[model samples]
Target: MNPLFRFICACLFTLMVLAVAAPGQAQGDGWPVSIGSPAPDFRLPTLAGQSKSLSQYRGKIVLVNFWASWCPYCRDEMPSMDRLLKSFPKGDLVILAVNVEKRIPEKYRKAPVSFDFLSDASGQVQQRYGANRLPDTFIIDRKGVIRERVTGGIEWDAARVVSYLKSL
Candidate 1:
């Protein structure tokens, strides 16, 4: 066995082991909410002038979405979010759409909003969740552990997404 060949083989084996041991590791880098992390608790006002807290949804799957009314991505994804909310049973899942603005826009206050439209006027709750991007979303499991974190906009009602939520 040549010395150089043995060294190269050993390095390749080590790299393969590391890669298999740490699948999906890059998904958590720089993300405020990571899979397996406890979802941060927050209390914020709802569009109807009522205050709501994350703890209230314990033992159920919760989707915490941080968005601003003016964000185009947020606007685009909202309809899909509504559909996602409707897909679940009344108490099986809770979707908290936290508005990161001073006032809940009239458009959002009007008809067809199914989820809990929370008002994070001071951005405190958003900051607590580390939601740096508009339309950031965290899916928490029944145990209140964040199972998934998605940045930017995505179709929340997509079949695959719905299936994943159901599995949790």
Candidate 2:
């Protein structure tokens, strides 16, 4: 066999092996929640000792953020989310910050925000949403359909982002 042909065959074999090993490599973050899917309904206890469900906000745009208090990015993006909350009229939008951990961090004890911070003690809600990574966000329309799935941190109050939400 020609040496060049052997090298080409080896490379092809390696490529084939990689493709089979990681079938989901093409997906940016392997988020199971595909865009346009119905947002999974979940009831989680709020920081205020109340329970909230995604279905309750069916007539409003909902931003379901999966985050942990210790995650710096989650903390950083939260303020912008507050600003985003203020942009629209009352009841137009609902921001649900679902904390994956069991305990609410002390830092949030006094932090003022318009959004609701809920606790996912059992992590069942996180698993249901496939939020394995911190700072994952799902933008659900008024009809409860997930319009977007964001994998990482972003300026939630950016003009373009707000405009996009407004359009929805």
Candidate 3:
């Protein structure tokens, strides 16, 4: 094998290893909060003008979703999320959709969803949660410990996902 080819292969292998290992070890800025970490508490204004805090939902299973209206994936997964919220009885699960965009889109303000939509216009709460990516979701258990961190869009209302959450 050529010397240059060997060097390239070694570098590629190193990069692949780092990519696989990074998320499990990532902390602080620019990374999603690791699973099992305490969900970061924040109080943000709602579209209705009232403010809500994560600590207030400590006794309930909280689904903290970081999303933007401009992201198609975010929009696609929203209905599933709404269904997920509705599947549980009131107070069983608390879904807080934190909008990271500077302006809350008009459509969302009018959408009929029981869960609260919060405004993180300054992105302080988003950064604190390390939700640098759109459509990041953290499932915080009743005791306020983060149980799962899901990046990208998913079928949140799927039976398997809902069942897993119910078991939590």
Candidate 4:
């Protein structure tokens, strides 16, 4: 092969490998709760200006979502989240939405979000969840164990998922 063609082929092959490997790359600090490890506690301020601790909600199901206002998927999932919470009898499930400050938009600045919106501005909580994607969610059982996790955005209010949520 010609020298230039060989070099170009090498570059193309390298790009291909990187492209395939990119899916495993860390999108955030890689904070998705793993099995057998305690979920890290965080004290994040709610949109209402009150602070909350995950540990404080022991014995209740928690749906923790790492999201950003700019994420179209996050935007799409918000209404369902709102509806899911409203459909519940309150205290059965709680949402801990942490806006990764770097990419979040300003429009999401309000309080008493149908559920709860927390901030991971410093990425402390983000780092804890091994969150590699936006709208990543973990369904914590009432006993505080992470039961299920969605690395990509999820339609949590789907009939099946909602039923599962209700069952939890």
Candidate 5:
């Protein structure tokens, strides 16, 4: 084997190892709150102008989603989230859709959202939750410990997701 070829192969192998390990090791960088971490609490005004806080939802499984109207994935997964919210009884689960956009879009205003639609106009709440990406979701257990952190869009009403939430 050629010396340069062997060196290239070794570099490629090392890169592959890093890529595989990145998700677990990069948790602090990409996901500020890891599984089992205590979720940060914050209070923000909902679309109805009511002040809401994470602590207020204690004893209930909460799904805190950070989103923006301009994000296509955020908009796409909203209906599924609403459906997911409906599947569970009112007191069984709480879904807080925190909009990070400064201005509320006309479509969102007109949309029939069953969950609590909170407005993070200044992005303070989103920042506290370390939601740097749009459509980030944190599933907090009844005790207020974050059980899961999902970044990006997903089918909120999917059977698997529903089962997991139910188990929590």
Candidate 6:
């Protein structure tokens, strides 16, 4: 390769890599998605052989949870999520319960449960929602703005979160 051409190619490659890594450069804390940024869209398969998309749940308040069966906190939070889903006063609240456990096809499919159970065996969905910790919850308001993000375990039906959802 010619020297000038090689230099140009090197610069271009460096710029591309920098662009891909730019999102992380300024962020030093825990939250992955910014408060005002549009919630990242994802399409993953549900345990019941259905596909779930974040974009499809627009026009409603969405509670996006990242959890695993092995995590005790995650296990504890399931009931709250279920209750929240069933008992929420209005039809505008939706829960997208995502499981980050390994894809155990039969067990996931056969398990009888309430609420939508989607898979993120590769953890891509989890990372997108800033669910680095088990049982992380993100509340995306009706306007598709990510309003709140709670790390670790949380009561999805808690009054504070509920009030915010209601306001949306």
Could you give candidate 1's per-residue lDDT for residues 113-168 as a string of tens digits?
68888888897777767798889999999999999889999998999999999999
lDDT by candidate, in order shown = 0.85, 0.88, 0.89, 0.78, 0.87, 0.78
lDDT of 6 at 67: 77
Candidate order, TM-score descending = 3, 2, 5, 1, 4, 6
Give the per-residue lDDT digits (tens) of candidate 5, residues 6-113.
999999999999888866754345445667877878888877779999999999999999988889999899899989989998888999889998977766766788
Clashing pairs in 6: none
Q: Pick the candidate with the highest lDDT.
A: 3
Off by over 4 Å in 4: 1-32, 102-104
Candidate 5 deviant stretches above 4 angstroms: 1-31
C-alpha root-mean-square deviation, each candidate: 7.9, 5.3, 4.1, 5.2, 5.2, 7.4
Cα lDDT, model 1, residue 70: 86
Better of 1 and 2 by lDDT: 2
What TM-score goes with each of the models? 0.78, 0.80, 0.81, 0.75, 0.78, 0.74
lDDT of 3 by residue, 82-117 (tens): 999989998999999999999998889888778889
lDDT for position 160 in model 4: 91
Model 3, poorest ten-residue lDDT window?
24-33
Q: Tens digits of per-residue lDDT for model 2 on 54-104? A: 999999999999998888999889989999999999999999999988898
Candidate 2 stretches with Cα past 4 Å from truth are 1-31
